[model samples]
Target: MTDSAASPIDRPSFGIALILVGMLAISINDMLIKQLSGGYPLHQMVFTRSAIGIAFGLVIVQFEGGWQILKTRRPGLHAFRGLLVVIANMSYFAALAVLPLADATALFFAAPLFITLMSIPVLKEKVGPFRLGAVLVGFIGVVIMQRPWASPEDLGVSRLVLVLPVVSAITYAGMQIMTRKLGMSSKPSALAVYIQTMFLLVAGLFWIFAGDGRFAEGTDNESLIFLLRAWVWPEGVDLWLFIGLGFNSAAVAYCLSAAYRSADAAIIAPFEYTGLLLAVFWGWAIWGEIPGLEVKIGIVLIMGSGLFVFLRERQRNRPLASDPPRGTGATRR
Candidate 1:
């Protein structure tokens, strides 16, 4: 986390590029996780990914400032942030196991909307009419995807299960908020390492207590089947894939942290939607999972709302000739 006080040079274009690259890495990570979720326990996959990610985090932390990076006055905040991320990851991967990739990604995009709402209380930030309207539009998109007004037959059993991704998005928003709070106090590598540590602990506990032996021979629910599935000895190929996924995860985390630190978040944040394009591409390429018409509509509404919010922020924060210094405006930091 870079200090906000020591202003960095404005580089919104470069920050946007970094965010796009990060989202691409994240999409690759999701593809690998979805591929492995078929045969492996979610916990086991998390354990493997986090174990390798911790190694990457260590190298990054060392490069940043060696052991001095570990010195933070806010261990409790880091731990809470770590817990939020662990829960977010669990909920997200669980939904990914059952839903189409594009559909899941669409729901997760609500995180930004959630962040906008959460900021009112958490950061004491004032929300003007434009942002409020964007938030409402975003939730309308969520309801469209949920389709609670539909008949029971149309709703299907998956309707209830699909809520997991929404939960994931909310928790992810909270995690992002916490990241902003701690951004000035901790190193980005330290935050990454903390979350990886929590992942290892959570996954290890799940493996020990919820291993395959505890479940019946057959399970019908896709989400549960993915969650409670027993860990197995990874074959050589799966082992290699797990290793690749860890590095991919590290790249995503570092690039995202760097992007936000480099320029105004409003400028860089819209590019995060690049993940949806990659999600659609990978979903079609790998699984032939084209989103249905209703889902496509929902995706558009959510994305459109998010883009509108970003446009409003950019306008609100635009620099004026009367403004004092280059670093004082919203666009600068």
Candidate 2:
């Protein structure tokens, strides 16, 4: 009998482990951001984080292929992808300032559904009824999570602020699609460098225009404060925390890239749901906030539907025991 321990199926288990660890690290990053959002401008935080992140990416590039790995033929795609990430980052972090962590995370989980729908048009991938139904169910979960019928959750924040995470999800999905498309020919480290550079540029521009003076007004609006806050010098502890986030950012970028590269996306995608559990834990532990029963139900629905989509795709890809032909799956169309 063959040694199952070394079987090909087991290879992806390592990838799954990397992904889980990455998610946990990222959750810690979010927790820190949530804590600091009240005190610092989002752009300043991003500027600090990206400066360190760029250093980290360059180190990896040096070890991977020594600067040559940074070369790419599709600079425009890289720039566009980086811009999407910046938008997603700003939107989600802005929501973090006002929304409960778990709520923001649950709503952001809709990215997979968005990706599924976007792939049809962008990648020209076929989607069957099962996957489509899963996407619809996932969206319903988003609506429930909003709890619009109830009183406003975040100091009666504007509906526009509440919608930020959903916007983040959409842009995040676009970034993921671009990542998949570029994965065909681009180096992952190069992609990281591009995104980090974009963050640096965005952070600089934000500081230039809004770093001081009248743009810093309106601190009274809780929802807008995170964005409009001036670039104050981060205090000692917060300074250290901001510096640490750079390492966190690089770890997240590298681990996520490594995970997807190691396994079929169908196998790795479901692991993204782990972010919900971590979010819940951090929210309760750090802020004494528990998601209401309705939000919990919404989380279950979103996670279940996303898992179903992955499982369904896996089933479609699996070869049947009785089938002899290997290339006849409808999903291939």
Per-prediction backbone clash count: 1, 0
Error of 2 at 189 (Å): 2.2
lDDT of each: 0.75, 0.74
lDDT of 2 by residue, 1-333 (tens): 110111122247966887797788879888998999878888888888888988998988787567766666666776787788898888888888988999888888888888888888877788889888989999999888776786765435767776899999988887766655443343445556778899899989988888873565855656577876788898789989998888888777777665654665667667867888999999999999899887898898899988888787778894111111111100000
Candidate 1, residues 229-275, lDDT tens digits: the string is 88887888998898898888777767776676567766777788889
What are the clashing pairs of model 2?
none
The prediction achieving the highest lDDT against the true structure is: 1
The superposed Cα distance between candidate 1 and the true structure at residue 248, in angstroms, equals 1.0
Question: Looking at model 2, which ten-residue stretch has the lowest summed lDDT?
Answer: 324-333
- Give residue 188's error in model 1 in angstroms: 2.1
> TM-scores, in order shown?
0.89, 0.88
lDDT assessment of candidate 2? 0.74
